[model samples]
Target: MSGEPEPGLVPEHQRPRHDECESVLLTVDGEQFRVCAQAGRPGAYDFDWLSGPHEYGFGLTNSGGLALSRDELVQAIREFLAEIDPATGYLAE
Candidate 1:
């Protein structure tokens, strides 16, 4: 419950094999959770960590430059993953 993905839980596949850009990737507990807009600007993605709950969400811009620091992204992804509960499908709810 203290920010970690469930041990031995196989992460769900969170990506489409053939996306046409405009995608966001949420990394929670070492797993990739992604959502995307097929018609939006391709690969314009960003993420934010949800504190206290250990969850994160990603968004993709229609058309904009990518501006995410690697350190921040990594931290956010880890925190997001830690928030997920394989049994409940949420932040330890």
Candidate 2:
């Protein structure tokens, strides 16, 4: 899907004003996922993943309070996807 965020996944009014926000589309096992991160207060990141009508998200912070690189985010997404239960399409408990 050109690896671009789907139009309207994030509303314009809710988007961060800064240019630090980054987003991309990824497909895994034929499922399309939208991943996004915005630099938050103190340089940490608020990130989320959206697939169809479901979304999972969290904040991320480190001692250094640096933003995660795109590659790093992608790796993290892969790990997150690995934990999803195929039967329910949600993270396994």
Candidate 3:
């Protein structure tokens, strides 16, 4: 795959975390975080792993969450990343 990154997906490190596929992979601490777009009904899409890693595994606990709008993507990512506690699987206040 090409190393070029996508617009919405952000890359961590120099690696091509973001690919042509509208998805992003980030590594925080020793944890690997990934989010991808899932197709919904016609003319609709939702992001998987919106809540980020909650159980300290590869994927986040919140897989099939509400579909976020374009404007909300960045804020949602920030909120989820800030709230998730990898070890405890609990969101910080």
Candidate 4:
């Protein structure tokens, strides 16, 4: 796959309901963090470990989790990364 960086940290403004397939690599603490976007239906989507050795994950939703949105997912990723153990190297100085 191309090493080219993906779009900005912001999620796409007008993405299709079933066409979320963006992937990006994030460098943290000298390690590469790979984040991929998937399509979620009206309900919850099953969590799967497609690639990498990420052993931690966090799930966040709307005020009531009425439905999962791209923005919410991105926010969750940011929060999760913030809570990673410093020794794990998932976090940087």
Candidate 5:
């Protein structure tokens, strides 16, 4: 959301358990969403929202072992955002 993580959503020291995965705080329409991308097996990525009770995520990778690009990551988060109704914190109709 802001430059800092939303209170209680993440601890200051919170880190991904897996070394291959990296996390970033993404802001869309002024709402903050944490996106984690795991460089799992070749040609696949494991994505998750490691921020709250309402989890929204997806993954994409190429069979050629291409890593998840920044655009892809943001797009994933955007899709997640589209599903959530910010006012009510529920799925958007």
Candidate 6:
């Protein structure tokens, strides 16, 4: 094979930059969230609540790693949503 990744494989150097990464907007139970690939870390993702008062709510107290599969990410979002306080749109202390 040539100096290239196999046809079905993605090479690390060819990964998209942070700004170029595609973000997904999800509305779960009327709460909006944005999920996108984390910068400098391939296959890793970062997420934030678009309708929450806290900008760093997801990161502030979350101990989960950024690297997660699509399904895992969705599960994490659900878990995060469960922790939110409907009255304030912030995680429960």
Per-prediction TM-score to the true structure, in the order listed: 0.35, 0.53, 0.32, 0.36, 0.47, 0.56
lDDT of 3 by residue, 1-93 (tens): 111112232234322223533565544444444545433322222233434433221222223354444444544444455655657555544
Model 1 stretches astray by more than 4 angstroms: 1-30, 33-57, 60-66
Worst 10 residues of 3 by lDDT: 1-10
lDDT per residue as tens, model 1, 20-85: 544455554545654443343443443433332334454433334444444444554565456557
- Candidate 3 has what TM-score? 0.32
Which lDDT tens digits does candidate 2 get at residues 1-93? 012112223454554544556666667555565545554544344445555335554444444555566666555556666766778666667
Evaluation by TM-score, superior candidate among 3 and 5: 5
RMSD of each: 10.1, 8.1, 12.0, 12.1, 8.9, 12.4
For model 4, where is the 10-residue window of minimal lDDT?
1-10
- Stretches of candidate 4 exceeding 4 Å from the true structure: 1-52, 61-65, 89-93
**Most lDDT-accurate candidate:** 6
Kindly list the per-residue Cα lDDT of model 5 for residues 1-93, writing each as its tens digit.
Answer: 211112222332443455546666666556565555544555454445555345444445455665556776566566665666778565556
User: Backbone clashes in each candidate structure, one number apiece?
Assistant: 5, 0, 0, 0, 1, 0
Stretches of candidate 3 off by over 4 Å are: 1-22, 26-32, 41-72, 85-87
Superposed model 5: Cα runs more than 4 Å off = 1-20, 42-65
Q: For candidate 2, report its TM-score.
A: 0.53
Q: For model 6, how many clashes?
A: 0
Q: Is candidate 2 or candidate 4 better by TM-score?
A: 2
Candidates in descending TM-score order: 6, 2, 5, 4, 1, 3
lDDT of 4 by residue, 1-93 (tens): 111112222233433233364444454434444344444433232222123244333222233325445554444444445555657524333
Off by over 4 Å in 2: 1-34
TM-score of 6: 0.56
Checking candidate 4 for backbone clashes, the offending pairs are none
Better of 4 and 6 by TM-score: 6
lDDT of each: 0.43, 0.51, 0.38, 0.37, 0.51, 0.54
For model 3, what is the error of residue 63's alpha carbon versus the real structure, in angstroms, after optimal superposition? 17
